[model samples]
Target chain A: MTRFAFTVEFDGRPFMGWQRQAHGPSVQQAIEDAIASVTSEAVAVHAAGRTDAGVHGIAMRAHADIAKEIAPFRLMEALNARLRPDPVAILACEAVADDWHARFSCTGRSYVYRIVNRRAPLTWENGLAWRVIQPLDAAAMHGAAQVLVGLHDFTTFRSVHCQSASPVKTLDRLSVEREGDRVSIHAAARSFLHHQVRSMVGCLAMVGMGRWSADDLRAALEARDRAALALNAPPDGLYFVRATYPGES
Target chain B: MTRFAFTVEFDGRPFMGWQRQAHGPSVQQAIEDAIASVTSEAVAVHAAGRTDAGVHGIAMRAHADIAKEIAPFRLMEALNARLRPDPVAILACEAVADDWHARFSCTGRSYVYRIVNRRAPLTWENGLAWRVIQPLDAAAMHGAAQVLVGLHDFTTFRSVHCQSASPVKTLDRLSVEREGDRVSIHAAARSFLHHQVRSMVGCLAMVGMGRWSADDLRAALEARDRAALALNAPPDGLYFVRATYPGES
Candidate 1:
């Protein structure tokens, strides 16, 4: 058996989410079907992160097992050819050792959220951005976001349905930057609980809209209760950007 | 009768074009419907530029006549309220002299064309940008673009159906800039022949991909024939960004 890893890109608007559900289509099911079409092998692919509905992925990492002996790049080409009209593409493929699990081997993950702050309706970026008609204070949001950039019990930000064993996760980076009418929030960590990024963005938005102060965010972190945090931002604005692995620069 | 001049924004995917058409919906018809809904006035709105199918307008200026005395800002709000699911909006409105014409009073027009140069398929910016898989040479394209940025008879780039009385128009600016994966072509002029922006982008794209040289562009322009240029790029990636009028800030 050969273990192969793949980097994927997808527009998640059509799928229910990354995971398979009884209701609708999923990103994993699409890849699994494509793998079967190319290699005639039914393999369960493991992704580095399982994104939610309407959330996009730029370079998602996944791993699968196949019995056939094929070149890595050729496998990518075959899979992409079969995955037509789905808005998903296999960016790159590589052979890896059996011990390299897509989820377990990932050391860090990064995500970006886009916000279009303008009075006019979004033309080209209608579904891709979170539109905020009023002006936002990006500097204040950035200053408030810095307070959550360390090891802490992120109980207030974790989703109620999150399956993580513990709420204590080390957040390595959290930054916000503004360019013209767009504001981007970038977050990185070893791993994050489900809906954590969206939850934090909700709080940051409060600071941006002058509804909450920096001290309020710090207080929410210290409270360690979900009710102390703001509502989760919409999934349409979120993106699972990429994942990092050891010795894989 | 009172005349009002207004700035508008719209997502052009749903409309046939800026002009009112009998077969399908259009930006002009949408605004006209909204204006009649607001003031019970049967109005005909004239735009600064009549864009083609799938062309977006960021700040399209238009003028309409109303029988009732309505506040400019209130007229803007009323029209926008009626244009809700269609994604058309009136950004600003002001009462102007009855002689003011949106198409003739404009002193300058500016446009932007977006090109996404990358290998992966566009997820967030699918319809908003022109995705070119190969890497682009922005400097080369810019060098070639400067050759057309002055007073000239642009017959080589004019559309066959263009209604301009003369092909001679002064181009004030034609610049290309690259930021990461996005290559933007900006053009400014007092007036332009139809399809000028799309035709220029098609020529610039060839120079950007190293398929055509600077001298090739000069030869095409010198040919003074429409067929001398390459294919006209799609109208979906074109945006009429703004128009400047005399004594307006």
Candidate 2:
């Protein structure tokens, strides 16, 4: 069996999430079904991160093992052809070492949350961004986001449904910036608890709207309690941007 | 009667264009109905530009005369409330002079065509942007675009159905830019013939894809015939960006 690493892009609006569910469709299920159609094997697909419903992926990394002989280009074209009618695309496919794991071998992950700071109702970007009618102070939000950087117990920012073993994780970076009427929050870490990025973005938005002070954010982190969380942002604006591996440049 | 100038935003995917149509819904009809619902008067709405079907608008300037005594804020809020279920919004509304006109008083108009230069299928920006799988040379397109940025009889770019009396119109600016995987074409003029912007964008795209040269573009313009047009871009990626008035900053 040969292991193939795939760079996938998808619109998360139609699926339940990345993981397979008994009730609804998923990104994983879509890809697995496509692979089965291509190779006639029901192989499991693993992703660098399992994004939630309504979230988006730019270059999400994944891996699957196949027994059939197939070129990377041919496999990518076939998979994309099979994944049609679904809002998913395989950006790239490459052969990797059989032992290389998509999740375990990942050294870093990055996410971005988009917010349109305008009173105008979203037209093109309806479910692609969070709309905040009130003006946002991006500079202030950036200043306050620094409080969440570095190693910390992120229990306040983690989801109650999160199945992680521990809440202590090292946050490499959290930055906020404004471009035109859009404010983007970018987060990078070795790994993250479920809903951590969205949770932090929600509180940062509160800070941007002058509803919370930077001290309030620091205090919330100190509380280390879910109840202390200010807000949990909707899944619409969140995107899994990229994942970094050890040897890949 | 108070002349209210509105800054409107809309997703044009659901309409038969900006004008009122006999057989289909339109942005104008939707807004007009909303205004009539609020004022109990069938007021006619006029726009700076009559954008074609599937063409989005960002801060599109429009005006309507209302005889009812209503505050600008209240009217805007009511209109927004009534425009629900449609991807349209009144971004801003303000009272203007009696003689102020949306179309005749407009001194400048600007449009943007978005092209996603990527191999992957678009998810979030599915119908909002044109996807070109081939690599585009934005710099070349920009260089060629300069050839059309002056006084000329733009018959080659104008549509056969254009109702303008004369084809001789001065184009203020035409620029092509690339940001990551997205290529944007910005066109500005005092006014434009029907399909002028789309026609120019299509030819420029051909230049970007290395199918045509700068000399070929100049020759097409000099030909001054609609038959000389290479392509007419679809309305999906076209957006009526802004309108400039004489005194507005």
Candidate 3:
């Protein structure tokens, strides 16, 4: 028996998300089927994050256990070959110890949300970015984001269906920057509540548009209710950038 | 009569090309329909470049004549409102002199071709970039590109069906650079023979991959025969970045 860790990239547009569902295709099912084709084994993959539909993954980490012995590079080649037309690929494969887990061993994660702040309807990036007709004050949005930092109960910014044991999560960083006509929001943390990043970005956008204030955000956090939060940003703009482990750099 | 000059942006994935065709939708037809909806006058748009299918446009310039007087900014908004779900938008509009033409008045044009040089199949930029699985040598590609700069008979790089009377074109700049796993080829010129940029990029990519040599490229250019060049690069990776006029900043 051997354990292998794989770095993956996916479009997420055609799948029903990362997890398998009865009704539609998923990134997980695609990889699992590819593994079955290559190794003739029913392998279940454990990912560091379960991204929503229409989201994108640049460097998602996952792990699988297989009964057959194969070279790491060959494993990558076989999986990629079998995963055709699905817009998913295994970037790297490395043998790991039994205790090495893609999810449990992850110490840090980062995500980026994109917004095209212009009037022209999205052409190339139609389903890949949040297109806003009105201009957003990115500096003001960045200023409001500072209020949400530190250890706190993020109940107001979590999805109602979130199954996390606790709402308390420390947000290590939340920064907003502008380049040309696009606004990008980067968030980093050890772990996050479900929909936490999207919810926070949605509220910050309001502040950037002058629809909400910094004090309004503080009040929403203190409310400690899911209903107090603004709308969740669309999944298209969210990207699971990377997962980090200790001494893995 | 009023003449309006507009800058447009489009995804270009669905259209046949920039010019109208009887068999399929084109960017010109979409814009013409949108213009007729707003002004109730039949207008024919003339663009600086007639881009091929699957080629995106960041800031394509066009000119049209309308019978009624309309503010440039308002016309842009009205046209955008009518473009529907075709992924086309008017970025900006301005009144121009009757003698001005979209194609004739352009002093310079720039294009960017994006190639993803990595093992992972493109997820985030699936349709936006061309995926090259092998590693590309950017410095080598850049070096080879320098040989094609300046005035020359570009028949070897022109499409066989190109209708231009003369094959002589001057390339102002042909630069290749890489950022992480992506390689970008930027081409600038006062004007280009049809399919010149894509042809050059196709050959340069071959050189970068070591499948062809710099000497082969020079021989192809000097041959002055259409059949001397390699295949034209796919339109999926091409973008008409912008068209610059004499007085515009």
lDDT of each: 0.90, 0.94, 0.91
> What fraction of the genuine interface contacts, i.e. the true contacts, does candidate 2 reproduce?
0.62
Error of 2 at B218 (Å): 1.3
Ranking by DockQ: 3, 2, 1
- Pairs with backbone N, CA or C atoms under 3 Å apart (clashes), candidate 2: none
Question: In angstroms, what RMSD does candidate 1 have relative to the true structure?
Answer: 2.2
Candidate 2 residue lDDT tens string, B1-249:
899999999999999999999999999999999999999999999999999999999989999999999999999999998998899999999999999999999999999999999877767677788988889999999999999999999999999999999999999999999999889999999999999999999999999999999999999999999999999998889999999998999
Query: Which residue pairs collide, candidate 3?
Result: none
What is every candidate's alpha-carbon RMSD to the true fold? 2.2, 1.3, 1.6
TM-score-wise, the better of 1 and 2 is 2
lDDT of 1 at A7: 91
Residue range B70-122, candidate 3, lDDT tens digits: 88888888898899788898989999899989999999999999999987666
Q: On residues A43-131, what C-alpha lDDT tens digit does candidate 2 reach at each position?
A: 99999999998999999999999999999999999998899889999999999999899999999999999999987677767888999
DockQ of 1: 0.44
Residue-wise C-alpha lDDT for candidate 3, range A1-249, written one tens digit per residue: 899999999987788899988999999999999999999999899999998888888889999999988999998998988898788989889999999999999999999999999887887787788987677999999999999988999999999889999999999999999999999999999999999999999999998899999999989998999989977898878889999988799
Q: After superposition, how far is residue B213 of candidate 3 from its true place, in Å?
A: 3.8
Better of 2 and 3 by lDDT: 2
lDDT of 1 by residue, B66-164 (tens): 988889878887887788878788878999988888999999999999998876555545566788877899999999999999998899999999999
Provide TM-scores for the models: 0.93, 0.98, 0.96
For model 2 chain A, where is the 10-residue window of minimal lDDT? A118-127
